[model samples]
Target: MEPNNDFEIFLVATPGLEAPLHAEAVEQGFADTKPVPGGVTCRGSWPEVWRANLCLRGANKVLVRLGGFPAVHLAQLDKRARKFPWAEFLRPDVPVKVEATSRKSRIYHAGAARQRIEVAITETLGAPVSSDAAVRVLLRIEKDLCTFSIDSSGEPLHKRGHKPAVAKAPMRETMAAMFLRECGFDGSEPVLDPMCGSGTFVIEAAEIALGLRPGRSRSFAFENLPSFDPNAWSSMRQQQPLAKPDVVFHGSDRNSGAIEASTKNADRAGVADFTMFQTRSVSDIKPPSDAAGLVIVNPPYGARIGDEKRLRSVYGSLGKVLQTKFKGWRIGIVTSNAGLARSTRLPLLPPGPIVDHGGTKIRLYQTGVLT
Candidate 1:
């Protein structure tokens, strides 16, 4: 495998939400876009990889495909790994972590494969192999072929670096952004979340509408790569100036603590002016008068033993409020229990794919404009 000037950028996606991620890559003007099972792959330069980390909201992580070759055994893999031009992508001073996965390959022992690559990087490139290294080199061996990639995002893109406050089972920023995309929000319309745990949905929506880069407040693994040009990256990052949002976003919760957390989070995100959070129950929620947009909520499903029954009243009351109000506004409800969503009696369309939220399986149920 030889390092080249051209390469593929793999945008790691949250499983079951590949469609929205794929759509996002295409919309963001990435080239040769294609969707795979766990992520989306596109072709670009190193700078483009940097841009993907900063811009794409739906991407969980960004990986740069280094190269690949065929290897039938451990000896062949070790020999090839050493000759793969580790210097082209890795520096001798920085540490790296090598991870390997094997399936349907002659080199079935992933641990041994990882050991070989770690030795190769250490001996050939003079780089230390640390378990806690931010720079990760991933090796995937399938059908006697080995492909290598570098994780350009050190921290998951969801961190966004600004949101320190979170609620129990708060939705990852990546997942929240995808759901907003699935709901057809293009940043021009207002968004509302009644049960906005830590205001994930509300903050994400405000960022999108205002053209704020998710990576603006964070650092990426690509900064340490051999090919990275700090001046060029700085120029690229500063080229796109922020824009003011035309419409305001809203988030409310019955818990006063949740409201306080959301307010602090929104202010830290620099979207407090364009967004609002308040301590209010679902039944008291009211739509803004100016614009009709999407209402999205990630409510608790109470999937544990005897928990669903207790949550029925919450869903029922939420439905009553939205049905009578919020005309012409789209709605999306994310919950694990289909029974709980049905109790709302809102005209929900077919469910989206089952997504892994922490450990529980959840799906998004949407509706046409509420009549």
Candidate 2:
């Protein structure tokens, strides 16, 4: 498929992690990074889109703008929707879903607006629209302007198509990746997640070290688009060499169920060979090897476990364990409760920006040397 030069790609991030996302985007060689309300906007081609999806650790999803038009009323919306070149991107056999959101616009009725869009697309391109469609076309009407885009990613990028099970309050894969990046992990050194509930940190670390594409195991909505070229996709897929890491990646959880879940998830992510999961508590945790490494933990917050006091003790024990056991290793802790995190008295620097995980605002606290 020919690349669309006029389109813009937006990397949507968690609420307070826009700066990190912007930095990561620029580090990954994006031409420009514009900090927006909830994310960063970067200009790139289809290859860049693929790279962003693979390399970006903080972005929730990458959206490509297909078309836009100013519409103050319903008639203009209908007329402009009809003018969009839907046939260029969508296939008639692939069912499409229309989702609409409005802000400060005359078309306040989202249902009516979606109906107008569906009618316009079906009438103009002979494409079928269903509520349960696999592909989604998002419509945004803000300040009398309507923006249209097809969701390049069907399932949210966090799914990664690898993890089939989750523990209580599982950390998102994207957030886990970003947190690891923030801790200065580059896949060259060992990474230990002492409280790795579902092995997100370890798996993401292994993927980064080995240059594995996070999207390799997952299917995208764009794959079903009319413009999708199987030859190009196959070439791209074949070009990525499998990454094998020699360093140790370790994760431990108190619950045997969590350890089992992490093992299965790592296996699905194709990083099982690089990772080691064990059933152990934080108090019993030790560095993977005598060598210094990055230690990241996403322990239970009070909200999920319903006992802030008990979790505080757990955090205190973790801090003591880190201070006495792993002296030179860097420590990263993700939590929603600042008080609970403060219990880990390791002379921690100010926590990084907050991120939304399952509706809770959580922050990352880093301590020790980031070697």
Best by the lDDT measure: 1
Displacement of the residue 38 alpha carbon in candidate 2, Å: 1.9
What is the C-alpha local distance difference test score of each model?
Answer: 0.91, 0.83
Query: Candidate 2 residues 32-139, lDDT tens each?
Result: 779898889877766666667665667888888876889888988998888888888788788889999999998898888999999998998888999888789999
Query: What digit string (tens of lDDT, one per residue) describes model 1 on residues 33-138?
Result: 9999999999988988999998999899999999889999999998998888889899999999999999999999999999999999999989999999999999
Q: Report how far off residue 294 is in candidate 1 (Å).
A: 1.5
Residue 167's lDDT in candidate 2: 80
Clashing pairs in 2: none
Best by TM-score: 1
Q: Which 10 consecutive positions of candidate 1 have the poorest summed lDDT?
A: 301-310
